[model samples]
Target: MIFIRKSNDRGRSQTKWLSSFHTFSFAGYYDPKFIEFGHLRVINEDTVQPGFGFEKHPHSNMEIISYVVEGSLEHRDSIGNGSVIKPGELQIMTAGTGIEHSEFNHSQMDLLHFLQIWIVPEKTNLTPSYQQITINKVLNQFVLIGSQNKQDGTVIIHQDVNLYVAFLTRNISIDYSLKANRKGWLQLVKGKIKLNNQTLLVGDGAAIQNEKINLQCIEDSELLFFDLSSN
Candidate 1:
């Protein structure tokens, strides 16, 4: 089965320096019916002004993943990790017991656009951790950004989930064979595409609980996919 989440139906909030959309229940936008999907908890599309960003905040028992779509994001955490994530970079933070971190735009003239994802960890109180990977080497194929084992340069998380990113030009297509008993979610970060015969535009998403999925690029597109188990 495949369920589509239209881009326009998501919760939206706009501030003078920030614009965001929530795919699941987050912050002040609460919807019981859309609280979560399996272990996938939060999917937030955020754009920050050149000089603005999220202040230092605390998190616990959740795996946070950040994907930069445009511009750059400056990150600093209590774990002694500090870096600037430019376009095509992935950052993952595991707030096992607890952790404090802050994200900033860092750029004086360019706005920062990125996605923040939260997934429920399989076990709590493990340990707080941070890692970032650059994807400049894998621009054409789907690159593993986050996984349980930290393989393929991906940051290790506490759950049995895999996150992948792909940059596809027009007419490019790929088929992903879903593992037995596993589910998938595809989010179109930019441009247009077709997933299992369903057309998806930017900010659109599809939850596929089926056996397989076929993704075809209708235009230049950047996409994110999550393969998760139904725990």
Candidate 2:
């Protein structure tokens, strides 16, 4: 089964320096029916103005992952990790016990656009950790962006989920076979695509519990897919 979450249906908030859309219940936008899907908790599409950002905040028992779509985000955390993440880079911070961090736009002129995702960790009170991976090598295939193990060529999270990003040219097609006991969430970041005969535009998403999926790029498209364990 596949359920569609239209882009316009997401909760939206706009500030002078920040514009954000929430896919699930987050902050002041509470919707009981849309609280969360499986272990996937939060998906926020954010655009930040120059010289603006999120101050140091605390989080616990949650795996936070950030994917930069445009511009750059400077990240600093209590775990002694600091870096500037640009497009095609993924950062994962496991706020196991407790951690404080800040994210700011690194560009002085260009606005920073990105996606922030949070997933419930499989185990709590493990340890606070951080990981960043450059995805320049996987521009051709569906690159693994997030995983639960450091052995993979991606950032490790304390969750039983896998995040993938694909950049496909116009008229290209990609087929994905879902695991027997796993589910999938597909989000179109830019351009247009057809997933199993269903057309999805930019910002649109679909939750798939089916056996397989066929994604056809109607236009040059950039998309993100999350494969989550059912257990």
Candidate 3:
């Protein structure tokens, strides 16, 4: 089954410096029907104005992932990990126990665009940690960016999930099969694409279960695919 979460239907939070669209319940956005998809908790598409960003905040027992779409993201956390994430890079912060973090736009002249994802951990109270990796997306091919076991040098997350990304050009197509009892979530980062005959535009998402995903690019696009446990 394929259930779509349309771009226009997502909840929005806008401030003088920030604009965020939530795919699930988050902060001040709540939709009972879209609370979550399996263990995938939050998917926030955010844009920050020049010289502005998020200040220190705390989180616990959640696997937080960051993917920058444009500009540079400066991240600093209580765990002594600090870095600048540019386009084509991925960062993960395991907020086990608890942690305080801040994210800002490194470029004072360009708007910062990114996605913030949260996944519930399989177990709680583990030590907090952070990791960042450079990922080069290949056309029409799945690139493993995060997984339970750090597959293909991807960052490790404390959950039964695998995150993949791909960049596609017009007319390209790809296929992925889900194992029995597994679940899938697809997020369209940029441009348009057709997922199993259903079209998705920027900021759109789809939930899948017990199905094979067929994707065809309607234009140049970037996307994220998640393979998750049924639980």
Candidate 4:
């Protein structure tokens, strides 16, 4: 089975400096029917104006990953971790019991565009931690970014989810074999592509439950694929 979620169909939240689109129910945007998919809870695409950002916030029992597309986002947490994430970088945070963190634009005049992902943990109350990696070395193909066992040198998370990303050239095609009892979500972050027979543009999302996924790049593209265990 496959379901398509158009970019405009997503829930939207906009403030003076922040414009966010929620792939699942988040913040003030609520839709009971779209609460979550499998263990993939949230995928928020956010744009922040220069000199603006989110203040300290509390989270628990959730594994969060931050991917910067443009500009830079600065992160600070109660765990005494502070860093600036730039384009082609990722930040992972495990808010096990509880943790406080803040994300803000690291620049004074550049718009910050990024994706914030949330996945439910395999077990609760484990431990709070942080990890980061630079993906400039892995471009033009699907590469593991987050996983449970440090698989493929990905940032370890507290869930049975494996996150992969690709930077594909025009007219390229790639195949992914999806294991039985598992499902996947493909998100087109930039440019255009064809997932199986479905054409997806920027901000479009596709959920696939088939045994295999075939991606054909219509143009230069950036994509994120999540392989999640069926619960």
Candidate 3, residues 183-212: lDDT per residue as tens digits?
Answer: 999999999999999999998999998788
* Top of the candidates by lDDT: 3
The better-scoring model by lDDT among 2 and 3 is: 3
Candidate achieving the largest TM-score? 3
Off by over 4 Å in 1: 136-140
Sorted on lDDT, best first, the list reads 3, 4, 2, 1
lDDT by residue (1-231, candidate 1, tens digit) is 999999999988899999999999998888887898889999999999998999999999999999888999999999899999988678889999999999999899998999999999999897898888876546547778788885767778789998888888889888888878899888999999988889999999888896578888899998898999965
List TM-scores for all candidates, in order. 0.96, 0.96, 0.98, 0.97
| Residue 160, candidate 1: alpha-carbon lDDT | 92
Kindly report which residue stretches of model 4 are placed more than 4 angstroms away from their true locations once superposed: none
lDDT of 1 at 123: 91
Candidate number that wins on TM-score, 2 or 3: 3
Residue 56, candidate 3: Cα error in Å is 1.2
| Per-residue lDDT over 29-84 for candidate 4, one digit per residue giving the tens place of the 0 to 100 score | 99997898889999999999999999999999999999998999999999999999
lDDT against true structure, model 1? 0.89
Model 2 C-alpha lDDT per residue in residues 61-136, reported as the tens digit of each score:
9999898999999999998999999997888888999999999999889999999999999988969988888885
By summed lDDT, the worst window of 10 consecutive residues in model 1 runs over 134-143
